[model samples]
Target: MGMSDKMVTVLRRQFEPTVEMLKNLIEVCPDDFWFDAKHKYWKQIFHATTSMKFWFRQQKDEEFIIPDFGKDVTEDLDKECSDYPTKEEMKNYVEEISSVARKFFDELTDDKLLEPCVLYEEITRTDVILMQIRHVQHHIGYCNNILNSNHLEAAKWL
Candidate 1:
């Protein structure tokens, strides 16, 4: 019923849907298709999830200032992308991140929610969280686009 609680609620709500969308995208295409650099579907998901984890760790450390990737942000996700983990690996990544997020939410105090913290050096914590949500949405949109382009369909979320 406090600000922290509300924020955590919103985050938790977004988490499951985001993971489901990623799973759907992965399921729609074969492993080879995901490795295709031309489509960049897996690349988008990889970057988004990896970046999220990086930011989450920074936040937990109360570092406030976000690390800069500089121009690397523009690199195509699929270029030299062989390091990507397997589908099972990705699922484990999601589960681990989700668990950390839940812990952060449970322990977050209302005062901390209101405290101003720098994100990415210039942005605030509030903005960082918002960006995180948007990042999830962006990847999901990419997945939808890929599915559509391939004339494939994602399973409806029940």
Candidate 2:
């Protein structure tokens, strides 16, 4: 398979379980916990999704653009709703990020993957993508821990 194809495959495989894990977490955790200052789980999820959106927009060999974590994103996220839509919101966020990933992967050439591009002036594009994946996994692990701490069992997707 081509480099782009391989990357897409790996992204898909990694995200599938992650989607399930997030859903299970939302299902188990209380709405109050999402807003708890100590945990701030929901805020972390929002930031992670927003970061993924930015990264997925990048072209192979292109320098990654850091997203503006300005008031708009944070303000909307902070608004308290009578009912929480954590799972649905996360699913939609993932879908948007996946669309960008598809576009990026489709346009990528093997040579482009090897081309050097800076991320944050220090890290390379190659390292940035790897870090993005790792970041998502880290948040997923945190979500699982939160659920476990609440003595709530996540649904089995298999």
Best candidate per TM-score, number?
1
Best by lDDT, which number? 1
TM-score: model 1 vs. ground truth = 0.70
Check candidate 1 and list the clashing pairs.
Answer: none
Residues 36-104 of candidate 1: C-alpha lDDT, one tens digit per residue:
666776667666766666556545455433222222222245355434455565566666666655565
Off by over 4 Å in 1: 1-4, 58-78, 82-84, 118-122, 155-158
Per-candidate clashes come to 0, 0
lDDT agreement with native, every candidate? 0.59, 0.57
Residues 78-101, candidate 2, lDDT per residue (tens digit)?
Answer: 554333335456556556665765
TM-score of 2: 0.62
Residue runs of model 2 more than 4 Å from their true location after superposition? 1-12, 15-24, 27-32, 35-37, 59-87, 117-122, 154-158
lDDT of 1 at 138: 80
The Cα RMSD in angstroms, rounded to one decimal, for candidate 2 relative to the true structure is: 5.5
